[model samples]
Target chain A: MADTDSSQRVQEILTQATEELKSIKVPNDDQLEYDLGNLLVSNNNTLDETLTRDPEKIDSYLHNLARDSIQALLNRVWELPSERIDSDIYATLPKPTTRLPREKPVPKPRPPTKWEKYAREKGINNRKKDKKVWDDVLKRWVPRFGYRKIAAEKEKNWVKEVPSNADPFEDQFAKAAEMKKENVAKNEFQRLRNIAKNKKIKVPSVGVTGNEYASKNELSMAMHHAKHATASRGKFQPELPNEKKVKGLGKKRKIEFTTGSGQVEKKRNIEVLEKMDKPSLNLDGAIHKEIRDENVAMDLKRKGGKVYGRRSKMGGRHRTKSDHKSLKLGTGFQGKGKGKGKGKGKPKGKPNVGAKKKIGGPKMQGKGRPAGKGKMKGKGKGK
Target chain B: MRPLKNEETVLVFTKLKKYIGSNVRALLERSDGLYCFRLHNGRIYYVKEDIMKFAATLPRDNIVSLGVCFGKITKGGKFLLHITALDFLHPYCQNKIWIKESAEQNFMYGNHVYKSGLSRISENTPKYAGVVVLSSKDIPLGFGVAAKATAECRHADPMDIICFHQADIGEYVRNEEALI
Candidate 1:
């Protein structure tokens, strides 16, 4: 009976323990248990003894234990608050130093001196000497001084340089030669002037005289007589020995003209008719005949007129019946067709006919339809 | 419940285990009420609160194939009331138990509570004890461990077991044993 009580007491104690564990809250028990398990296994401790007295209590006891241990640890950690850091710790950090000193200033360059400017100008002047030398070598020497003074000096030098060995006779001979050349030139000029006078006439310039002389007739007559004698001898006629002999001269022939009335009349010189006391019809008739003959000849030579052998048969004749008839026929054909005579086709009429035909013929037919349809249909209907 | 500390966590699970025995299962419960399972095999595991509040937390959709088993195992002169299978637990919880097989793999004794299995509940009578079994195949690797009845207790209010099995059975199958 005592052993039974002991067993009952133990059971009651276990029940009480389970009730108490249930009252305690277990937070994140699974993870806590895992961590605790790892810790135990690493420390070489058995998990069964630490967890429960029997397997029935294993899961419940482990969960409660894990919860309690984790809670206690968190409470302990929270109890000791994190320490605060000092504010002055930032001051201990190193500070940056100042930049290095500025570099020394570079020196400025100086300007050119006055002597350099003067030397440059002199160098430019020296280069101009070539131009001066070129001018001197050309020998177009304009005197550096005044021209009058230079000329006077040159003349004085010439006078002073005259030599005594230069011969006066040689100078005289040169003057005589020059005078002879001048006399010869004068004579040649006079001879040319005389030849010109014989041809027609001209005055000589040897002496200036107010009076002028005319040619004599005797010289002229002698020249004419000599020319006649030579011409008679050249003819091969026998000359009469110093005697006068008369030879019959050919008689002048006269011409006569017949009037259209069949009356023969003597021909008078046209010039004599003009000098006559009375005006004559014969000369007027002759002039008219000549003018008519020239006109007929020109007409025959005109385009398409009949041509005779040497002279025109129609010369000096008025237009005959046939000629007038031909002229009328030509005038009629002037603006009309010559037909097949010239081997050319009929003459063309006005050019506007073709255009007029097109506009009036089909154009009138096109108006029967509306303007747009008709014009469009015409294009579509074309071959 | 207060937040758990690092020292308290070590003292209850890691240090206290040396004073008691090695069969104890330790865990930490989270503030969001998630249960973390720590087994004797040095593995840490987790169970969501919204899955199975009275048992181990897990997803509601995963409850369709859930199973649980409870039993006893005496080790190191301490009588341990052990939970052998609870398939509805999260993968983290299975890792914490440090079992050779996960809830999705076959049961440890060749018994599956989801299809045809035994009950996981147990009596608190003398010479007989209750065990809370929680497991899942949601975790595919590693292990975890934790203490119970401390602030870090997870999955249940008062943990009842000293040791639990939390393991990714796939990992064991891949590494330790080959398939027949």
Candidate 2:
């Protein structure tokens, strides 16, 4: 009778669990089955076989079972005495130790040698003495036993030593010096010759002359004359006389000087003056005749006659108003106007027709107004 | 390894104490200006200017996001690196983190980042790179990889490889706790 009552109670619990599972939604489709399978596997036979057909019912059953089982297991473990369990584990463990193997004493790290100590302190090993050498080519002190040593040595010894006496350098030097001196002299001579040629003076021939002193003097004089001639070539004035005059002497001294050689009385034949006499002027007729001749010559020249003063046919004194109007009897006078015929008797006083009037009085003469004052009622207004 | 404290100042101070010596003390302490830590011993062996510069160059918050370590690569070559500073760089360096190229690039990149006033390191070298510190004999002492190299390793400490690599087991691990 008790087993029947327990079975009915389990059935009632499973029914409530199925209702709870149906209420809860599965979060993911793919893992839902796996989750439900895991729940059923843990519960095994504790759930009713009908719950397997419906996963939702099985889920609730497994969930409650897991919670109750976990709690029961935890309670059982907690009931055990802590000290008893610790002792049991301790007893099974290996023994503890305070010391370890000495580790071979670390091979007793060898005490650093003197050099090693120095190197450690200084941070590098000292270089060897034989390794340092002066590199003449590089002009520096460098390691002698390195890759550049051979090249350095070769550069250092590239110049071979020659015996002093075996060299002909002295003779060569002397020859060069002599040549240089000759070249300098030649240059100087050429320069002087150029200067002479530029001055238009002839260069002296390059040879010894028997009259060396005379020739030198002559040459100097010639050069002086050439310079003087060149200086005065375009000038035309004579030098002033250098004689000095004696001032304020007596008349007797003057008379004595004059009588000494200037007043010699030697008689000689005197020459007579000759004159050619002719008639004087026949006044009236001669005056008229001369006037007629001048008029005739002037008229001829004006008529384009070949006269002495008519070389340039267009010659005349600039025309005054009277000269412009003076009409020649046979020549036509085309005066400046609209007609070929003569204009009204050559207008007088500059033919004042188009002449600009002189701009002097009233209109242009008045000061309009005083500056800084209004246009009307000023002191100089209309004056 | 024990997780490092997040505070930059405390971490720097602790590193200074650990590597320089426990006897060292903070000589001039100022986070705003320049901070100096000195050894209390009479010799007063102190952290160098370069170390302070390196510390100042670090990103304020993320310094411990990556582990860092310092030691003399040789007698004169001192180095500092994030445990992950060279993880990506190691393959290119033939897997030897202490080699000259690695050390030099680490220092050079560190200095470049510092000079640029960048909180983050650069990535590509030979272009946006820094110079490496070399010994008198031209051996690399330390390098500075751009902060980008560390970032590429998911911000892992470069020195962590040296600490956790299998071959480093006997040499680096003092105990089982060290492996953790």
In candidate 2, stretches whose alpha carbon ends up further than 4 angstroms from where it belongs are A1-46, A83-383, B1-9, B12-180
Tens digits of lDDT, candidate 1, A234-300: 2655544663332322486432211111111001211222233245458888987776555445444
Task: State in Å the error of residue A365, model 2.
Answer: 99
What is candidate 2's lDDT per residue for A260-289, written digit by digit as tens? 221120010000000101244578899877
Q: lDDT for each of the candidates?
A: 0.34, 0.35
Model 1 misplacement above 4 A: A1-383, B1-12, B15-31, B34-50, B54-180
Choose the strongest candidate by lDDT.
2
RMSD of each: 61.2, 50.9
Name the lDDT value of residue A36 in candidate 1. Answer: 24
lDDT tens per residue, model 1, B34-145: 3322222211222222222322233334432211211111244232222222222222231122223333244433232231211122222121111223344323222213
What is the Å distance of residue A64 in model 2 from its true position?
Answer: 0.7
Error of 2 at B162 (Å): 48
> How does residue A47 of candidate 1 score in lDDT?
60
